[model samples]
Every structure is written in structure tokens, then in C-alpha cells.
Target: MESKTGTTRRDLLRAAGLGLTFPLLSACGGLAGGGNSSKNQAKSALKIGFVSPRTGAAAGFGEPDAYVLDLAKKSLTSLTVNGTEYAVQILDRDSQSNPQRSAQVANDLINSDQVDLMLTTSTPETVNPVSDACEAAGVPCVSTVVPWEAWYFGRGAKPDQKDAYKFTYHFCFGVDQFHNMYTHEWPQVPTNKKVGVMWPNDSDGNAIRAALGPLLKQSGYTIVDPGAYTDGTNDFSAQIAKFKAEDCQIFNAFPIPPDFATFWRQAAQQGYVPKIAQIAKTGLFPSQVEALGDIGIGIAGGAYWTPTFPYKSSLTGVDSKALGDGYQATGKQWNQQLGPSLALFDVAAAVLKAAGNPKDKLGVANAMKTLSVDTPIGKLEWGKGPNANVVATPILGGQWIKSTDPKYKVDFVLVENSSDPNVPVAAKLQEYKP
Candidate 1:
């Protein structure tokens, strides 16, 4: 967990398939401010548990999240709240994208590790149980990647149940936001182009499909029967063939990393190049594009942050170039720049500042409820009105611009910069498919 002087060493390790590991409390000693009673410490060190998929099909996204958490934790040592020093202890567990395993990890983090707060980016199936555990324990949990709608309205209601979850907070945009962006902006896209969507058969996929139905109807586009793939399936040739049969002009894929890479590569191999290709989650990380090589060229999707975007906030001083450079200096190639992680950390900082003490979970949750801080993305305030879940925040979008510079050897474009979460759908969906 030692911070490298530059990102180069870490990048080399990541490229070599050697994942980074955080130092355990026993090994790090008092460096991370652990092993001391809250009363003995000037400001209690907050132990924030993170349950993310580190060694699963979504590792491309999960790994960067873990790295971002590490960076955030290191950054916190230098942060001061009202001139009082504070520290952070990040307890990380890999969910492996399995619901049962994720539940075990959740229970351990909450009941055994006694974590003050927890952060998650699990898929819908895995997230529900964990959210239930946190809610029952009265622990504050923040999820950066879980679709907001699923958490707000439980997966199809049972015969006799209300659809709502009270304890989980969503910090990222929901599927409705992304779907609205596309549907509202369809008028801007040339008419008569066939739209082929390939979404996973899960809660995330269902949500997108539910939103797409009304949007496509309103936009006057012929929706080719979308193809559905199981979450971990590799072969997409049959699905691609269906799009080819429909003479698909635009392709929208919502699969995770390796599958996304496989689909894009196969599409190119089969000469199935759409006029414009759009991917949902693939563009979020740089590694996904890197894994696909030239196959990912011209692909557009919404992302949280990128190097080209302006950071219009006092929290980070508004210089995105320096942040990108610092990330590059770590020896890691700046691909999917860590947008959500940075924003989440800023939120964590706000929570700590408001609580005035890290050991108080209830006090921290109350403080979070009142916080309205400006972040690198934009000003974020907890949703406080009646019927508000209190754990979710607005989402912004960015594009991936292809970079050819040898200094930055990556081919992805972040054309659309991150905007405020509430940007009108028409404005947010400005087409970048060309």
C-alpha cells in the first residue's frame, strides 16, 4: 500500500497481471492509525469497508475502483478537518460477482470487522442482500455503481410486498438517466438508422429495456429485437448475427469488460461494423478499450469523468490536467480516469467533516444527510425530501476520445465532458458517435 513515487511501477505490475494488495493492519502497524482505542486517539480513524468485484468478470471496473479507494485513503492522511488530523482505514473484500459470497463479505465487514461505514459497487443480485444487512445494522452504506432504480424500487414486487429499500444509498446515475439521454437526443441522430441493443439478462439490463421501450416509441426509431446474453457468456456470434440480419446501423452494448472486448472484436471480424457504435459500461474504464485495441475505435458511451473535462469545484482546485498527470506519474496509463471514486472520496470527506468524529456512525449519517458540498463532478447534496432514499446522487456523462500521442499510448476519446447531473436530457445526449 506504499504510495509509489510515480504511477509507472503500478502500471507495470498491473500490465504483468500482478494485482496490487493493501497492507494489513498487522503489517502496516500504527501507520494507518489502527490498534488504538477511539478515546486514546485525537480523532478516531474511520474504517470504511469496500466490497467490490476484484477477481471476477468485471475486474476491469473493480480493480480501478480498488486503486481509487487506495488513492483516496492515502489522500485522506493529508486532509484536515477544522485543523484536526484524521486518518482512514480501508477494509476491502472481493465479492467475485457472486451474491452468496458477497453476503458473507457484507456480514463480516459489518458484524465482525465492525466497520463504521461500507462502500459497494456490486451488481443488483449481490447488492440487495448486502444493503439489507447494512440497513438492519443501521450502518451507512454507499454504492457507486448499483443502478439506482433497482434499489429504490425493489426487483419486481412479490404478490404481497411493497417495492422499496430504505438503507442503501446510490451515488451514481440510474438507467433512466442514460436511457433518457439517448431517447431524447434521437432526433439529433440521423433518422431511419436501425438500433441494435445487446444488454445483459439481469436487473441492469431489464431496467435499460424498460426505459428504452417508451423512449424508442417516442423517438420514432425501429427497435430491432434486442439480443440478451447471460452475464458471463463469452460467445456473442449469434447475437451479432441477429443485428446483422436487421441491418443494424447503430449498436448499443451493455456488457462487462472481457465480454465487451469479445463482442467488439467479433463484430469487427464478421464485418458487422455499425455506422455508429455505442457501449454502456465499457467506456467507463480505460482497460476495456485497451483490451479491445482498434476494435473499440469510434465507440461512444457515458462516463463519470475524464481528463478532458473541467473540474469546476473548490474541493480539487479545478485543474484536471494536474490530476491526470499525477495519475499518469504513478506509472499507470490513465484510461477510464477515476471519476466516481474521486467523487465518492470527496463525499466521504464531507461526511467525516460533518460528523466531527469518525467513530460515530449515526452522527456521520446525520451529518451526511445535511451535507451539500461541491465535488469535482458538481455540487452534490443528499436527497432529503420525503420519499427520498438519501443514499443516491445524480449522474453525469463523459465520452472517450481516442488518444494517439506516444506519451499517452491509449486510443479512446472522452469527447463529451462531465456535466452537472441534472443537465437536460437533450443537452446531455449530444451525439458523439461519429
Candidate 2:
């Protein structure tokens, strides 16, 4: 897959004016497609723009992006659509973990590059803005990694509306899945059922506070929310004090990595220790845990993708174990984001083939509206409920412990799978001592 860096004035005009694919894309200009319009308009190249946070705070979500892109480029040398062959170009831009940059790069991809489909992942900071840009430009977009509700509702897609965003589609776990996993997983730690929450004043934080908080309360767990705080707040003293006062044994948070690290270190210093500190978003990566030293061990969180999964990548034909092993061959630790990063391309391949004519924007968008495709994670089928545009994937609960292997310093052991029976529990849940 070729990357788009820039285009000359002539190139821009040609890209802007052309109703047909570039001449270089056509393999002998074979007439391939069923419909008359498709026969007349089967373009040669399909361009997809990918947005992610390759730098800044959320960089962990994008560390393996380049490796995954290389894998996709190798696997998908060219796509055979109908009877014609079409080369694929994936132009990726880093959001740098900033939302405004996300919107700006997405606009550039949509306007300058004239991408047919847009695929973005990481967090709402990246996904929401990119999706918004796609929705406004009438481009087809598929995003994962962000919570379904945060992407769906956080972007001002009304809950009561019959149709959510028309151009963008998302696939990730939702509040219901969080409720199911939390209710099942937390009971194993022998806590008092009091959950001390630090939901930030952001997209992910707001949605979880409004939705997951209530579910936890209804499930007989007392909630100790300290209200919403701004993202880079240094002092968590007041919040820690309250949790200590209430004897909150189960700590829950949905914050950016730095904020979480700061709060966690402060909590340890102030003696507001909990029995089960279940963190989301921040604790998914091994690097995040490694940064905390011994304090990070025994901390629990959800696993969106692990080597234990039985699913295989459609493009690479490598199962979860092989994918992990392949990445580790580079002497780097395996990350949870690897599966989702490559899965974005997997979804792109599916929709491109389903579009009939890869050049047709509206047709490709419509195809993504109801798509069932395989990825490194699992089968992602849209048009099911949580919302019309979302597919809730399985999230397994696990804890970070000292690694038994020499190659790694920490290991994540899956302790609960009631949310997903297909994945077996890796080990028993341990109570938090630090």
C-alpha cells in the first residue's frame, strides 16, 4: 500500500476532476463488474486514509502501526475487484494524540488525497475528530479501539435518533459489555463492592460515568465518584481523601496515561490503597505498567486483544500467537494495539471488495453499513445493536504480574471470561496489595 505525502498542482487537479481511477491502477483496463455504472466506472486504485496517535501520550496505541502497515502492504499487494485488478494505497497521518490535528489530517486526506475510505483508531481524541471530518466530507470511515458509546454518542450522535452518523462506522465494546465484565470480574477480588471512580471530563470519561456508573450501582456496588476533573490536573488529593474516607476497596478510572500514573502514584503515597484497582484505557499496554515498577503489578484491566485469542488475520493467515511472536521477533514487547491496527486494514479489504466498484464512494459507504469481515481480533459484523453503527467486541479482564519468562518483565493473566466464553481464563484473580 502506497503512502500519500503530497501532490503537485496538476496531480491535485487530476485527483479532483477525475471520475475514474488513475491510469496506472488499471491492469490492461479489463471491463469487470455486474452493473452498467460499475462496468463504466470500475476504477483501478483504492485509496484508504488511516489516522492514529503515533506520538504524544497515546503513542502506545500506535507503536506497532508502522509494522502493521508493512504487513498489510505485503499481504495486499493488489486487490482483484470484479475482474479488474486495483492497487491499494493507505495514506496514514499521525494525530500526535491531539484531536485538532486528527481533524486537520483527516480533512487533508479527504480533500487533497481524495481517499475513498477512511480508517482511524486509538482513542476518542483521534477517532471522534477523524470520524467527524469523514462524516462531513461524505467519506466512508471505520474506527475501532474507542468505546462504541464514546464514539457514537460522544460525537453528538443522538441516542434517540433512528440513524446515527451516516458516513462513519465503529466497532468496539460498549457500556453493557463493561458492565458485564466488571460485574463478573470484580467479584473475584473480594472487595467491598465500593468502586472509587475517576472519570475525567472527556469523551470516554463522561460516557462511562453516566452509563457504567449506574450499572455498577444497580449491581449492588456503591459508587464513590469524585465528579469530573480536567485532563492534566496534578492534584488528586481531594479524590483520594474521599475514597479513603469511604473505604473504597475497588478503584476504577478512565483517564489518559499520564493522568492515571500521577493519580496512582499519589494514591499510593496517601494510603488510599484498594483491593482491586481496575483501570481501563491506561493499563492495556505493558509499557504503561512497566513505568510504574512494582506498584503496577497486580493492577487489573481489560484485554481487547491477547495472544490467547483463537482468531486469525484474514490477510496474513496468522493466529494471535503467531502475530505476537512475529512482532516480538523485532525484540519489542507484544502490545494489545497490534491486533486492532492490522484489523483496520482487514476491514478495509473487505469493504473495498464489497464495494463492487472500489472507486464508488457511496457504494463503499453503504457496503460498510452492513459488513461482516474477519480480522486479527475476530469477526466484526456491523448492523447489530449497541447502536446501529457499532459492533461490540469481547473484552477480557486480567492483571499485570511479574513475568515468568525472561524476555518480558511483566505478564497479563486473564482472570474472568463471563463476557466472552470463547477465551479461557489464564489464571485466578489476585487481590491488590500495593
Candidate 3:
């Protein structure tokens, strides 16, 4: 193997006193060191593989992917590394929101496409399996959106394991975040402090059940767990019946999107509506709640990203307002995926440049281990994160408020930002009347 050692982009830029900016690889300008023609003539180019749930129950997460990818393509078409201009190609695949399929596509990217780096996001179903594949294949990977505790322990990793997977790095909130977002919202409404928790047998459900349930108990609230059920259980009558029997005034759940939609409708029909129905792993997006019609109003969940967030994209220098405005201007609703998806590319581009050798997988992996850069969500400090290979993003409380706006039938307002005060609170907490 050729020697994979040289100056990193961060080193060169800092030496010149230029902070992290994308203008170094300007779209209209020629290559940094060599001309554009030489970049095309390079024998090998840097390859990046992106995987997400584009066409499945969780497809809402990938709705803004195309726009973000288009932005990435334009900004990352070419870059200068160690005085050599290199062409960059990004390969995207749909995980279909299935763990098995996620692993398959990830394997193809590593072995077949020989991707120099891998990036996956959205949820544990997409992030965990893809990260596992990258770890087994020894390919450097980065992921986002999934709760950190779920991504770490959900993969059967222990808290004492430390750096369980070196080649894979993740950035997202953790179980503590969910607890914070929930406890902050639950007390706003009058209740008996009895929380009805519906945790399934899946990764998210198991992790939340283990951590979040105890936290609620410690906070002097009674937790009424109905036990773990399968993912696609058509009937939640038993669980609903238990909550109703216990007179649970506050409801919490971590379930798949479709499963929550089914259980939510059933709960309403069965007259088991709680004063505060805070859900996780589902109902984060507007479209998901829109499916619930008016019942979606007053439902609550955690928010990691929002159009109203006060942050900017490192790639396009686009602030949260511009990013959301651009999407809305194009006839598309704003989504949480926009920030993290663009952040993935921002981190990817930074990792590739910091690697000093884009073709060397080990070098790229090492670069990702300590890489830190500002993103549309905020500054991501991978090195300062919870684990050696993780960065904990902020999670705030939010609710879906009734609205007649055409852009969105219901408005996803930020109700609590105690965890991340930088994000302004958009509305006051409203008790769930359903």
C-alpha cells in the first residue's frame, strides 16, 4: 500500500486562518492546487455511500434526502487533498427501513462499490445494521438521528465496552434526552403522575424500556408498563385496557410509526386518551401526525431538528431559516431530516479532507473518530461526545398543534427547549383533550 500520510484540510485551512468553510472548493472555481482537467484524469476518485429509509414506513425521514443530496453533489463535486485535486462520487441507496435490507445494501457498498466511507441515518432500523456492516467490513462510517443509547446498546454493546466499534461513529441524542423532553412536557398538564408506557420488543423499545422507564419512576412518577409486544401487533386492546384500568393520565411509547398510528387510533376509539401523550420513535414528523387527522393535535414528542432551529449548514452556509425557506419555496414541507442529512455530507466532506488520503479506509475512519464541525443542527463535537465514537445532539420537547395552514395541516411547534435553549420555544404546552 502507498503511504497514506499528508497534510489535512483542517491543518491547511487553519494555517491560513480560514475557518471551516465550503468556499475552498468553490463551485465556479477550478481545483485548488491543480486545474479541473487534472482532477478528472485522476485514476481513482473518492467514493461515499449513503443509506437511508427512502421507501418504507419511515420514508418520511428520507423525503428531504434528494434536495440535500443535490446540495451535496454540487458542493462536493471536487476537492483538494494534499495538493492533489480529487473527484468525489456519492452513491445513495434505500434501506427500505428494514434491518436486513440495510445490512445487504451496506455490504454491497463496502464490498461491491468499494466505498471509501459510509454514512447512514434516520433510525436504529437503518443506522444500527448499516453501522454493524461497516464495522464488520472495517469501513469507516458515520450515522445520525437514532438515539445514542439505542444505537449503542441496541447493537448489544455494553456501557462499559467503551469504544465497542471503532470504525463506526454516531451523532444523536440518547435516552436521557427522551427523559428530559418527556418530563419537561408531562408536568405542564395536571395529572396523577401515572405514566402508561408501551415499549415494544424492538431495539428502540427495549432500550427506552430499560432506561427511560426507571427515570420516570425516580422522578416520583408511577410507571405502568404493559410488557413488551411484537412490532406489528394489530391489536393493542390489552395494553389500552391496562392503561384505562390504571387510569393512566400520561402516556408514553416508543414504537414503529405504523404501529403507533394503529395503537393511537385504537386508544382514541377505546376512550383511553391521556392528558399528555408523548411518543418517541414515531410522530416526530408532520406527515406522520397528519395521518391521525385532528387527533394528532396536542400529541407530543422530542425534537432534534426543526425549521425554526437557530443553526446553519456548514456546507452551503445556509442558516436554518434559509434551509427551511428554500424547501418551502420549492413546494415541500420542512422536515427534521434536512439538517442532519446535510450535516452528514458536511461531516463526510470534512472527514475526507481530514483523512489526507481519501482512498485509505483506515485513515478516513481515524479522521472521523475526532472530527468536529458546525452543521445545520449546531456544532457536532465528536471528540467531546459521550463515548469515543459518539456525539450527543440536543433533544427538545415539542407538540403538534392544530392548524389550518395549507403547507401543513398541523403545526409542529417547539414547546420545550430546556435541553437546548438555543432553539426558541415556539408555543406553550397544551393538554391533550382527546
Highest TM-score among the candidates is held by which one? Answer: 2
* Residue pairs with clashing backbones, model 2: none
Across 54-129, the per-residue lDDT of candidate 1 in tens digits comes to 7776665665665466666666654466666656677888888777888899999998888887777746655666
Candidate 3 lDDT, tens digit per residue, 200-306? Answer: 89888888888888887898899999899998999999999999999999998888899999999999899998999988878987789888988888898887888
Model 3 regions lying over 4 Å from their true place: 1-44
Clashing pairs in 3: none
Q: Model 3 TM-score? A: 0.89
TM-score, candidate number 1: 0.75
* lDDT of all predictions: 0.62, 0.86, 0.85
In model 3, where is the ten-residue run with the lowest total lDDT?
A: 21-30
Q: Is candidate 1 or candidate 2 better by lDDT?
A: 2
Off by over 4 Å in 2: 1-42
Model 2, span 1-434: residue lDDT tens: 23243334465456547754343223223223333445444366678899999999898898888888889888887899899898778898999999999999999999999898999999999999999999988999999999888988899978786467778888888888888888888888787888899999999999998889888889999999889999999999999999999999999999999999999999999988899999998989888899998899999999888888888888778788888889899888898888888888888888888989878888988887789988777899887756668888988889999999998999898888866787879888889986
Q: Rank the candidates by lDDT, best first.
A: 2, 3, 1
Count steric clashes of candidate 3.
0
